[model samples]
Target chain A: MNTLLDFLRKYNYFFVFILLEAVSFVLLFRFNNYQGSIYLTGANAISAKIGGLYNEGVAFVGLRNRNKELTERNIILEHQNNTLRETLARLGHVETTTEHNVREVLRDFNLIPATVVSNSAERINNYLVIDKGENQGVRPEMGVIGGGGVVGIVYLTGKNHSLVIPVTNRKSSISCRIRGGNYFGSLQWDGKSFLRAYLDDIPRYADVKPGATIETSGYSAVFPPGIFVGRVLSVGNSKDGQSYRLEVQLGTNFSSLRDVEVISTPYKVDIDALLDSAKVKDEADQLNGLGL
Target chain B: MFQTILSRIFWILLLTFLQVVIFNHVHILGYATPLPYIYALLILPSNTPRWLYILIGFCLGLCIDTFTNTPGIAAAATTASGLVVPWFLVAFGPKDLGDDDTLRPNHHTMKWGPFLRYAFCAVTLQCTLFFTIEAFSFFAPLDLLFNILGSIVLTMIFIVILELIRNER
Candidate 1:
């Protein structure tokens, strides 16, 4: 016992080093288990507080550019509104039930405006911290869209801040389809460039052109259909040759994303609850059928 | 002793702010990001207690991780680098330095050659460990290599510039 004590006393630093490293690795792996701890992330109150102050300064620096972009958007929106009004006047006598129902479905979603407090794009697993959180009606799995297009999905929500997993991240995958095309595929980041992503499971026979637009398929409850995702840069065969992988130029520039809207759909919560219960029942049914 | 500890804490907080707020947002060529927060761990006084050294490193890393939303990537890499720093000091630092020496590392103390070599090795070790843990997979080995190499070079340039400015002062 005395000799062991002596040994420990002599090499106590080694033990301390190992213990500290073990703690760090534990925190790392535990948090990497996918939304394990929001408090440990940038969305935490303290970090967000500091980030808010820093962002105020940064936001000031880019005010001119932001103004220019907003003006351009305003002009485009005005032109679109005029065209839409003319179309509405033309279709007044022949209003379709499908068009009315689509408008009603869109009304179920509310957009909560939020400012990005902290964001990065260089890392393989990039994250964004936004000012909106649970208190502001933001929730995990809700889609976030910037002025240009789809930004990301809320991964975790703190009280006043939320962590967003941008489309550039490896873990981010969205169901997408070519505009005016029936074929659907999953859009995933290639981990090489923030400007580009890949749409997988597109059959080789599909006429995927370089300039075709890709948008959300609305197959999942996360994002509504027809939201712009990206444009196809090139089409290539998947490694297995069973499907074609189209390289897509992402619509949202993540590096400069400042303002975003979180899609808050009350119907999504109901759908998720229903699906979860169905999953549980399915598991139970399988066990009972197997005599477990 | 109290004053020294307070000053050390202040320096750590300052460096953490610079790293989390400014350097974390920088993505030169969409790849390289300067991580000079490890500069704090690299310049620890020669006589700092080994346990304290490791703790400081871990806390510094954890603080940056928290602000950057990396959780444990920085903490783990910095701790591993801290584990090797003492041995590295003995190997690459000035030969005449004794345990009683509380001198902080600088080019003047260790000479330009040893200081540069030490910074390069330490920065490479930390950057490589960080990117490896971050990627956590061999699927994009090329991307991983570019990130590690780009970060190392960027971090080295920042460290050298910081040292030069300090020398001027």
Candidate 2:
């Protein structure tokens, strides 16, 4: 017993070092189950509160740019509204009731405006904090879009704030398709430039060209179809030479991202349920066929 | 002794706040971020207990992790660096120093070359461990190397500047 005490006394530093490191590793690996631990998430109340205060001062410095972007967005929205009205008039399906017009406009999705409180583009997996959260109808898996285009998707939400996994993150993958082409590919970041991402899995035979507009495919319930993603800057072949990889310039300038709109799709829950039931039914049929 | 401990606590908190509020957002060329918070570890007195040194490093890293949302990467890196600091001090620290000596490392104490070397190695170890764990993969070796090298140079610059400011006072 005396010898054991002596050994421990002599090497207590080493033992403590291991103990502390083990604790750190525990926190590290456990963090992989993202959003399960509120204390570790970026949108935790303390961080969000501090970030909110800091961004308020920084946001003031970018007021002019924000104003200009908002003005341009307003003009674009007005043009789109006018075109829709003209098409409706031509079709002789004019709706006089305001409720009908509202329903028609918001038939598929609703946009929840949120301001970015904290954003980082330096890390391999970048995340953002927004002012709106569960109290404001923000939920995980909902798509977020900014003035330029898709910002990211909500990953976690707190009471009054939320964390977003932006497109620049390596884990973020959005299904995108060329404007005129029916072929779709997965858009992913390469952990290099904030403005650039790669769209993979385009077939070799698909006609892809530089400067082509890329937009969402609407195959996922998170985002509706036809939202702009980026423009293709160049095309290259995958490492295996089996498919085409298109270099894309992401539309959203993440460094200056201030305002974003979370796409709240009420029908997503229903669509998810339907898909789950279909999957279960298919599994049961396969089991019955196998006599299991 | 008590007063010194209180002052060290004050500095740690101040450095952490600066790091979280300003330096965390300052990404030069979107690659290099000056992590001066590790400066708090570098400035510890040479006679600081090994166990306390490691504990301080862990707590400091945990504080930053909570704010930055990077839970364990920083803590692990900082703890590892803290564990090795004594060896580094023995190697690059001033010669003829006794075990009981309480000397805060700086350019004046260890001279420019040794202090720079010591700071560079310590900061590099911390940053390398940090970026590697955070990335958790070597898929983009070039980008990872770029990030590590950029952060080392940027952090070294900040550490040297802080040392210089301390000299003035």
Candidate 3:
């Protein structure tokens, strides 16, 4: 015991270093595949509160520009809605069947508006904290979309804040496909540019073109189909050359992401159950995969 | 003594705030994000206890990581730097191994040259490890090398400017 005490007295600091590093490595690997621990992530109350106040201050700085962008987006969406409504009226010969619009009929989902309190893009695995959480029905695995397009899925949720696995993260993979093409592939970030990602496992025989619009494939319950993902930038052969790897320009501007709309799927309970089931979970990638 | 601890805590909070609010958002050419929170770790009094240094470094990096959502990556990197600092001091710092408890790494205590060397080594070690851990599961080695080097230079510039200001004060 005395010898142990003496050794500790001499090497306590080294022991502390080792212990702390060990803890860090454990935490690193534990939540590596996904954000597993809420306390360690940005969704924790203290960091979220700080980030919330800070982003609120920053949001004040960009108020006018944000407003302008929203106004422009509103104008475009309104125009598209008008065109869709006219097309509906022309086809069905009824002014409207109900308050439910054509787009709402396509998918029974609600957009839970949320403000981004913290966002990072320079890092390899980036995440964002938004100001809505469990109290506001923000839960893990819900789809999040920004002003431009698809942002990411909500990873964890606190009482009043939630953490998001943003599109810029290396581990972020979303089921997506070319708008008109039947072939599909997963959209994944390559830890480089915030504006770009790679479409994985796209076969070489599939007809892909530069500037082709990519959209969510709706193979999973996280996000509905046809949400704008990005535009194809270039097509190249994968490292093994068995598949076509296409460079894609992501729709959302990750660096400047300020606002997002969390998608609330109507049958979340059913979706979550299916996602959690053993039989379904076995082919989780197929449920989340694009083509293969 | 109480006042010094209080002031150090204050500086840590301030640096953490700056890193979370401003530096995290500032991406230079979409790659380099100057982590100013590292200043808090680098500026701790050189005579600081090894256990305390390691603990504080872990908490400091973990604090920034919590806000950034990288979890243990930051904590591990900063703890590694904390472990190597005293040794680095032994090499480049003034020869006062017996009385290191009071001499801080500030320009006021050590000459600017040794101080800068300490800062460069500590910052390089921390940033290199941080980027390596972040890129371990992904990214090519060449890309990882570029990431480490680019971040080190950027973080060095920020730390130097901060050190200069700390010097003047």
Candidate 4:
């Protein structure tokens, strides 16, 4: 017993080291997984508070630039509002099939404003913390947009804060297509720069000129189609030569992102149901084909 | 003992403040982010128990991780740094490693010769671990190497400058 006590006492610190490391590893793997990616795990309140305070100080330096961006956005929104008002006036009171009748124009995509607390673009898998979460109706997988354009999707949400996986993350990919072109592909960050990503799987037959506009395809059910993504900087054959990949300049300047909005779509539940049924039907057909 | 504890707490707070407020915003060469806050664990009393090192490291890492939304990557790196810190003290530490509670890893305590080596090894290893964990599961060897090298060089430069200032003071 004496020798055992001595041994334990001598090596207690080493055991503590091992134990701490174990806890850290568990946290690392747990939080990085898809299920653990969203929740009250990493973006705790204390850190969010600190980041919020510091960000408030730094945001002052970019007041002019942010103001300019806001003005430009307001002008564009005013133009859109004018066109929408014209369309509404032309309708001239249609039938009152309101509640159950789903109109093609009523997308139900609402934007909830949020302030970015902490943002980083230098890392391989970058994340941002915003000042809205479950309490504010921000949920996992909801799309986010900043002053420039498409920002990212919510990964985790706390009571008063949420973590965002921006377009710069390695695990992020958005459905995008060239403006006025039928060819669409996945836009993914190469982790080389904050403002650059690549549009992949574009077939060789597609005409992709440098400086062509790329916008979200809206097929993912997350982002509304036709939202601006970026402009094509260059196009070239990928290493395998099977398809063409175009380098795109991202619309959002991630390094300076501050104010953003989370988009919530009410029809998400129906869209999910439709996708599930289609998946089941496809599996059933596959099984029947195998049996025959 | 009370003064020692207070001074130690002050150092920790100051270093964390500098890291969070100033250095966190400074990214160099488009790839390197020097986390001088690792100095939080580096400047402990030489005789401090290895367990305390790990605990302080964990707290410091988690604090920074929360602010950055990085989860446990920083905790893992700093915890590893804490584990190796005592070993470095035993191997290349100053002659007064544990002789006095006030002993620190500065040029005045360990003199210029052993102090630089200690700071260099500790900072380089910490930065390497941090970058590696940050880039975990990604096998892009060239990019990973560039990040590790760039971070280490930048962090070392900062550590040297900090040490010089401390000595002059």
Over A1-292, each residue of candidate 2 has an lDDT whose tens digit, in order, gives: 9999999998798888899999898888788564234335544777888989999989998999999999999999999999998667546734334324323444667888888999986899999999999999999999998767788899999999999999999999999899888989999999999999999999999988899988888888777777878899999999999999999998889998876789899889999999999999989989889535
User: What pairs collide in candidate 3?
Assistant: none
For model 3, how does the per-residue alpha-carbon lDDT over A35-66 read when each residue is reduced to its tens digit?
A: 34433563477778998999999999999999
List the DockQ of the predictions in order.
0.25, 0.24, 0.32, 0.27
Model 4 docking grade: acceptable
Off by over 4 Å in 2: A33-292
Q: What is the per-residue lDDT of model 2 for residues B18-126, given as tens digits with 9 covering 90 to 100?
A: 8899888988888888777788888888888888889998999999999998988789888888899878877998788876777788788889999889989898998
Question: Which sequence of candidate numbers ranks them by DockQ, best first?
Answer: 3, 4, 1, 2
What lDDT does each candidate get?
0.85, 0.86, 0.82, 0.80
Give stretches of model 4 more than 4 Å off.
A33-292, B95-102
Span of 10 residues, lowest total lDDT, candidate 4 chain A: A97-106
lDDT digits (tens) for residues A31-89 of candidate 4: 76632443344457668988998999889988999999999999999999999986685
Q: How well does candidate 2 reproduce the true complex, by DockQ?
A: 0.24
Chain B, model 3, TM-score against the native? 0.90
Comparing 2 with 3 on TM-score, the higher-scoring candidate is 2
* Residue lDDT tens for model 1, A1-292: 9999999998887888899888887887687864334325634777889989999999999999999999999999999999998677555635334334333445667879888999987899999999989999888999988766788899999999999999999999999999888899999997999899999999878988999989889988888897877799999999999999999998788888876778887779889899999999989989889535
Shift of residue A43 alpha carbon in model 2, Å: 28
Worst 10 residues of 2 chain A by lDDT: A93-102
Q: What TM value does chain A in model 4 reach?
A: 0.60
